[model samples]
Target: MKTSISKAVAPVAFVLALAFTLLLHGAVPFWGTPTLGQAVWTTGFSHSFVNHGLLPYAYDFGAPAPASIAFGLAGAYPAALLIALGMHPADAYAAMVALWLTVAFVSAWWLGIRAGAGSVKSTLAALAWVTMPVIWAHSGYSMLSTGIALLPFYSLAACMLFLDDVQGSRKIGRALLYLSSCLISVFMDGYSFMMFAMGSSIVAAYSFVMNHSTRRRLLTYSLPVHIAGFSLAYVLFALYIGKPSFGAAPLDFFRGWGADVTFFLFPTQGIHWMWDTLGLSVPRSHRELFGDSSVWKTTYLAPLLIAGLLGWLFTFSKSRIASAALIIAVAGLYLSLGPSLKFNSLVPQEIIETGVNMQHMPAELAIAPTGSALLSEHLPGFKNMRASYRWVALAAFGLWFLLLLWLSKAETLGARSAAAILCLAVIGSNLPHPQRYLEIPASNRAQFKAIDTMLVDDMREALQPGEQIAFLPYRNDFLVNYLAPSVPIRTYNIGGDKNLAMARENWPKTMRQFKMNKVDPAFADRLLWLLAQGEADAVVLPYIDMLWAAHAWPGGKIHQKQVQPAIDRLSATGLVDIDTREYYAVVRLNATARVLGQTALQAKLRQTLCLPGFCVRQAASSNAIHSRVGRLSANTLKSDGRRGFLVFGPYEPVESGTYLLVVWGRAPVPAGAWVDIVSSRGSTVHAKFSVPRTASRPDNILLEEKVVFDEAVDDLEVRIFAEEGSRIAITGYELRLARSGPDKD
Candidate 1:
């Protein structure tokens, strides 16, 4: 009776302690949500679910699919529930993390009991699992961190599937647990899914080899279930992505994001504040740590766990569990080292430099690639995964299992005392500094909330429900996406999903034309003409987006100088009415726009051949020249001494097929410059012609070229390559369709 009472009381005590620790860390159900990093991204998804239900648009102006499923489907239901209960999206996200963390802790403890640990040892192992530096460091990343938290649960489910000696209802329950865990694991994140798959496969193979009795059970129950569960999960994931392909992380990402061996021993970065406060700063002062980023340096293991792991490896233990643990731990660590070996961020230099023996030198940073490279290139699942450091999660779990084994062997009072100390050491070593908590100030949170409310109200006032809208500088999406949850308006500005990133790629190309001192009349007309055609009911220019784009674009200083002029030009087109606010402007189609159909709009946009000289960018220099000839004045950009690209750009999106480009510009004689129609960045040249030498006093040389675009292109530019020290002046140019038909691409 006393023992049962103690077990009951112990869990309550653990719960209280866990809550306090999470509170101190500013985790959710305790405080405000984080305002930085991936937290905002996670919050956006929760908000979408709360407002739009399950099949909300992912991004790129309502490209349909719940893109969040690819990142955090495991946490989506909980997040949605919290948000529905009036929690802020950020807080809801935090609550989801806290919930998973609690589940992880409970699962670890349960696994310990199943592994024959006493109550005290079980609690310690569970404590150690949740408080690992890797776990805490990744908490802000939503389901990625939750996936780490769920690893123990997955392990527990796998153990039961292979080793449990149950019958009838109990056996069915175990199978259900295994299936549920597998589904949740795969839904959580790819890293967690792959780790679970790898770890479980190892266990299954071992059981098959050693336990002949369990082989039929595994083949009959586990194999079929694995097939069914993984197949269903894949179909669900494909539906969530809305396509067969997922966002492909770049190849170099694998090399850059790989783990450093020393980071496993070194304290992670976020704990320095505690050391500084205690005057124990030396441990945190190392400036030469090798890793891609501070965030990736989160594989720190407790010193006690490391000693235990080493002891288990060296000892002559025939325990099958211990052997499996060692094998898994080594495999995980080796794979996490990625395709190279790194030590303290230092690489060996050539021995020839100091007349030192080559044998005395440290190994070079990277080898000429290895088996991991081949796996990443050719392996099915690995090809999609780039962050090899995440494999350390499996390593950490294996180490935790070894620690539990060690704990189970300790039977005396002194051993229990040592186990308690181990738990304390794990918690102390991994405790993140208070400043690491990404808590938003109450005032800032309230301010943002108010801004969102006002923006929603403003959008509603400007447009009717279901009206499609487009935001200017189209990539400014976080606030726009947040607004999506509250406003009834639909838009093309979706959250940052890579597949849809190119949905409106042509908008920037058109907007880039305005970077010059003055907007072209033809360009301004085209902008208005597109709007009048009703692709969207309105265009919103948020003050926040305008400010961001002013500094975020290339040649931003030039963009800043040209913004007002471009706005004025766009407004003067008179096709749409602008409703200006202090924080935003709404451009709505007027009565005149409603009457202008496709044919009239096309005729309006087809004002060809009047493009001015200032429209052509002087790639060599930014300075412009003003000249008057009789009654006519020209704004021309002169070339500097630099040899390449004296004139280029007005990079406008154009449909495929042949087009005529006419340039009225003058240059030094004897082929001083050559003009061509080329790809946006001038990589592919479509047509080229030499500039005609002009003996006239006034700078007027007519050069025309016919360029054929085999496919529709987003950024097509007319370029001029100049000889060194060649003087050139571009007066004007004209681009027109070589074939007469309505645009249909």
Candidate 2:
């Protein structure tokens, strides 16, 4: 009767555990918040899977395939199928998380049963493993980390290969299972694969060392099968991903992610409040030692779970599985400390002040570096192993596995009660608040849909084949910015600064045309030129200020003061603002305007003239004064005094030509103030005009002069000679080359 009851309880417990796991993760069937950060990248992968087949080369605005070889189609294909079935991407993602958690729980139970636990005990163990804090945290951030779902099953297969006595068909089956699990883990996530491989190596090494017969068995039976498995997986990975590239990173990159020793002893963030009242609180400084330090939050094990681990260590220390778990846990903890030993709040000030100086060390100790640095520097693949805190997952797994192993040996009522309590404690400790998963706002969703309709759908329908579009003030997050546009159009300004750099290098003519001395012309010119060159059919300038304000947490007002100048300058060019919405402006280059041969056309220049107290003076070699078309004016203008003359140019015509020069001036001029066009060859005044003080509208004055040059003279100057008390301003000028021909000498 007791046996039947226990059997009945196991299945019920498993079901309850699955439901609880979903509830804990907020992955309750069809409803849950979206995972943030790296999850966006995963959604992109799914998008690619839906649009193209598996192993797609490009997606997300044509960004090069993102680590897809390692990431495989494990989660992507399923999400894509759900999306095809009319589930929203967010809903589909939540479903995938649920499926991953279910697999993980079942795999844990299978491993426990393989390790000799009874049905009821293994079910409890599975529940404990599913609610582990590290798994929960990883699930919320990186979906790829869900590859840990396979770790337990793989560990079970490794045990059969290394420790168990199996023969013939069973041995072959175990070998095949081990190989498949390894391949699956590798495809699921590279980091999880590393953790599994490391633990397996340690277990295998221990087995080989224990006896000569075992070493021979490993050499003959295990090594060959594992090698073949690894080789096949590698060949497939290489074919899919091409050659892997490794880049060197700074020492600080390795150091910053190291786990603190105290993290293991303290309660996790979920239950830290309980510890706070007891005066055993973990320091805030330790919790956030680095930006990625939250990944290290997995170090917490409940007191009861820790007690179970202690019970196992004391009672079954000599057992092969216990020894292997111990070895892996210790090694994982050590490795997770990273390149140097800086234990957050625990490290002494003296040690920090002294720093690490290997130069003065003894010869034997000098060569042997500690922590992950030795492996990262010397090991080929280990250098790429960042986020050392992630190694804590292995340590956590080993401890939990040991706890289950110890619980399996329970026979006395007291021991069984203790095991049950520990299992409950584990679940309680890892129950995260639902708010951890970031909520996607309805307004943000609406905004994205609107942008897709207005920008993407409209542009796709309007543009001719092969025509492209550009987004101004480029953002690095363009993939997320324009996620799932209705029509597929190749986009520019997606590369951020790199795209800007390419524009600067390749589009020099455009750059020159928009170099108006007032502002940074690179942004406006590059965008306009991209359109002018027919590289793009339209330019979408998202009202970035308004967009940011609308998206700001707690809300913010739009401040377009800084970006307004760029918008105004773009408008000043021949690009007409075709559509203006609350969040963006769609502008297109005017087909009729001669944007290409701008240097050969008549150029207009304008400036504000001085009022009563303010005066204007032009520099002798000002490029601003140069006519954009004729290239015969100057721009070097400087303020003279509170009241002074406004002078422009020592103009030099490119060719000997008859020219029409028009000048517009506005000033409060005295009687003696006069405007003169003087020749550089002599002080001969070509034209002069005196201002009358009694003139009703002296501020509104226009002067047009047609000058004939006998030769291509180097210098012709325009000067507003004002009297001492007079204030005259030259508002603007226009220069045009005579239509017929140059005046002959």
Candidate 3:
């Protein structure tokens, strides 16, 4: 009963702490974006995991599939739960926050147990681990949130080491278990692996000193197998992290996290006092952290007192102290440079005139060192360790362990009271932070003015179930944000930042150079290919329109040629076509859209809708539509409650420049529509359809088809009529134009 009760204590505390974490992120509309001390790593991890099988869209570019099935599955946990229970993304994300906390709890408890810490000690250690100021920082700071997950696994590995040591087992079973953990750490992150190396170094060094006589025996036999297995695993997992460049290191390593460790416990600059007290802040510097929280600031609680008191009062051997210090040093350095003050972001990435002058280093730190090779040996599916921030977690865990050790010797109430006083003194003296205070609960975070309404209904309406898309409302796009918790609903897309990095023959061409390939190597060919393959689906193309400005294209096209090799393979299957961007949505026909649509177009549209197709407008009415999507005519049953003009087309594919679409119903560039022409070679040209500014104009909306064509083409594939199947009614028609030639520059 006592053991059970002890076990329950940490878990219960962890649950409460996690609940607090979720509530801080907001409950319903989970649109948390981490700011200064912004968690880029966390963002990447979450996105790569959540949007698992979707095409890459406007934002979520450069994301990779979860290399490992084990812990990499963390990203999908929240989405799966919410889905299982029929919950919304926001609720699912909130639940994820809770789930994340729970994972932290379990991991911490397991770590303590592994180390042979008694049940009570393990529980306290776990509680202390979750409540660390850094963990609190991540909670209040959404950007850093995903990175916290690494902490638990890290703790687990450390504890495993402790247990293995205690058992003094050089047996094969124990050795294999240790090796398994080494493999598991790789899936965690690149930094997690580094920390594991660091921590293991400390342990191994200590082991060497303590067991000097038996050291050779341990190192020669079991240790060799362990080391060999580890070496082989690394080569397999970290394939992408090829040839390291000792360039600049990562800034988050030191700056962003400084405030998390030493001072500014809740230095939420500029936020009110209430939230500050609860550990959430609305600092101007980290707006991404607390901007949406109108009611309650993202709240967090720092365990400064607990950690500090334990550090000062509890006595441990020199080795334990060193372990704690290393963790603090590494995590503290990263914090100091990141959230605390400033971070270096610029790197000269200019490609050389001859060969590439690749300055591939991240904004702050150098990529991991090289000598290592084998991915299968180190991390089969993923790198077990990375996310340097997790070291802070290990630091917290180490501190708690020492405290528990100290607590064990206490004989009376006086001794306990003495220890508590020491702890209180440390807590009181060491903690120096300004808190954020807000009147509302953090649950009611602000979206846009109508964002709450949109999330409740509009977002759902916007997305079709099983149709993949990214939902972003952050500095970066949603693919990089919401996808982490929403993983498995979709997959990573090479559409955004990565699109440029990608090419079509793009698959083989783009992937040929990488150390290890994406899970589905031929997975390249852009989000377009994946969509075509049914391996990928839709993209929630974020139409950058936050200011209520017109939603227009933020120009940048996908390079299908990069993944040509992958495309070639897919094409062989005949599920995909070899030529013409029309078969793939990215380079296919463009659609002229509005907020609403007209009666004639609506009739034509209903008939033309295929199992799935694209829209290409040949012409439109001259009247200026307000750019909405609904039935424009009064008699039609279709109506968008919010009236405006109209927009149409999830268009049908055109034969690129080969198809000459002569618009007769609407004049050249009709007022109600945008005449967007995409060439066979994948170039786009646009002309708006609007009312003529000419004086002698008679009709309110005259129909004119302005003829525009490529001077280079000898014969264009002509669409005989405006509708896909109907004959022409004949009025004045406008010829939609495309640019003259290949320079597409």
1-745: candidate 1 lDDT, tens digit per residue: 9999878877776777677545543465535543333455555556666666544334323433234444676776677778789887656666777777778878888887876776666877777777675666665455777798788899888888877767798878887888788778877887788888788888877777877888888898876766666677667766665555455554455655566666676554445444355564334222232333432446776564564575365331635666666677777887786666665543234434554432121324454453586776677677666677878888888877877776766557876566567656666666666655543323223444554565557766776777767665445355555565556666655544442354344333333333322334354443554465556677766555522322221112223333345467667766678787656667776777568776775556554322221122222222331222101225555566567765566565666656666666556552467777877587887788887776544435467666666776666677667776666666666666655433244
lDDT, residue 440, candidate 1: 37
lDDT (tens digit, per residue) of candidate 2 on 157-204: 678788777788998898888888777766677667778788888888
Clashes (N, CA, C under 3 Å) per candidate: 7, 10, 142
Kindly give the stretch of ten consecutive residues in candidate 1 with the minimal lDDT sum.
624-633
Give a tens-digit lDDT track for model 3, residues 1-745.
9767767785565556445434333332344421211122233333433344421121233333322222222333434445455654434444555555566667766665654555555555555555444544444334244444445555454444432443345455555665665654553334445555555555555555666665775576445655655675576454433322112233322222222221234334334333456655434332222112211122222343354345435444422443453444444334222222322222233422333322122323323322221221243221222222334444443444444444444446876566445434333322223321121222123322123343313434433444443221112232233332333333333322222233112232222222222223313223332333333334332333221111111122232343445545544433333223321221111122112223433333333321111213322332312224333343221223332333333222322222223433322322232333323422334323433322223452333443343343312222211222211122322333232232242
> How much is 560 displaced in model 1, in angstroms?
8.1
Q: lDDT: which is higher, 1 or 2? A: 1
| Model 2 TM-score relative to the real fold | 0.67
Off by over 4 Å in 3: 1-73, 77-87, 91-97, 110-122, 140-153, 162-185, 213-236, 239-314, 317-401, 409-415, 418-476, 479-745
Model-by-model lDDT, in order? 0.61, 0.56, 0.36
Task: Between candidates 1 and 3, name the one with more favorable lDDT.
Answer: 1
RMSD vs true structure, all candidates = 7.8, 12.7, 17.1
lDDT score of residue 30 within candidate 3: 46
Q: Estimate each model's TM-score.
A: 0.77, 0.67, 0.46
